[model samples]
Target: MDYYLLPIIAIVLGFLFLILAFYLALSNARRITKLGFINLILIAVVAIACGLLLMFVFTGDLANFV
Candidate 1:
């Protein structure tokens, strides 16, 4: 359970970021910079998720596989 904590925390944080980004995008629909902000957040979530997954996968922990 302890071994999974980091990735789980990361995923939860990523979801929060997604929700915030969506709200921002929705609230700024008339702005020309809307898409760029949303895209940046989306990219950030993907990158963070990937990095966390990789870290867990490469740890060689057979009992707690990602």
Candidate 2:
């Protein structure tokens, strides 16, 4: 395994999750609950934070991919 792989993977996967969450947020479903939206927001936030932290640990250079 490489030092860059884990954070890279986390960032890519996190982006995908973020996209999905945004899609869900954009969709209008009459029966959808507020809790579901909250969960999605949380997931997106945490995934993004986790990825960024990992990147920071591995690269120590923010705003650029590790």
Candidate 3:
């Protein structure tokens, strides 16, 4: 019900942002210099951190799930 909506929405948005970041990284890889690859990794790390933080805030039981 209503309780599930926030978590569901957060998950969907998290995935969308991750996908967008990955696609942007791929696109940049083709156009930018070799150093740009580092940016891609940074972006991925940040996305993962954000996703985990969101899950932690919403679920409050990260250890049990992961």
Candidate 4:
């Protein structure tokens, strides 16, 4: 359990970042500049990548138990 803590925290943070990116995108929908768009895309990409990577790692670890 303790060994999984880091990946869990990372997954949670990745979701949080995704939510934050969504909120920011919606809130700034009317006047998003190029820089803002790029930032939003970067945040989304990082969040998705982090979430997916950790999920794969978690699943792979679980597979070893079965």
- TM-score of every candidate: 0.52, 0.66, 0.45, 0.49
Model 1 CA lDDT for position 30: 60
Clash count of each predicted structure: 0, 0, 0, 0
Stretches of candidate 1 off by over 4 Å are 1-3, 30-32, 51-66
- Highest TM-score, which number? 2
Put down candidate 2 lDDT per residue, 1-66, tens digits, no spaces: 886787777777777877776777678664446787777677777877887888787778654652
Model 4 score (lDDT): 0.67
> How well is each residue in 1-66 modelled by candidate 4, as lDDT tens digits?
564565566666767766766776678776666677677667766766776676677678754653
* List of clashing residue pairs for candidate 2: none
- The count of residue-pair clashes in candidate 4 stands at 0
Top candidate on lDDT is 2
Which residue ranges in model 4 land beyond 4 Å of their true spot? 30-66
List the lowest-lDDT window of 10 residues for candidate 2. Answer: 57-66
Query: For candidate 1, lDDT tens digit of each residue in 1-66?
Result: 575566666677777777777776778776537677767597768857865775667575843653
Q: Weakest 10 consecutive residues, lDDT, candidate 3?
A: 3-12
Model 3: per-residue Cα lDDT over 19-41, one tens digit each: 66567667766664555655655
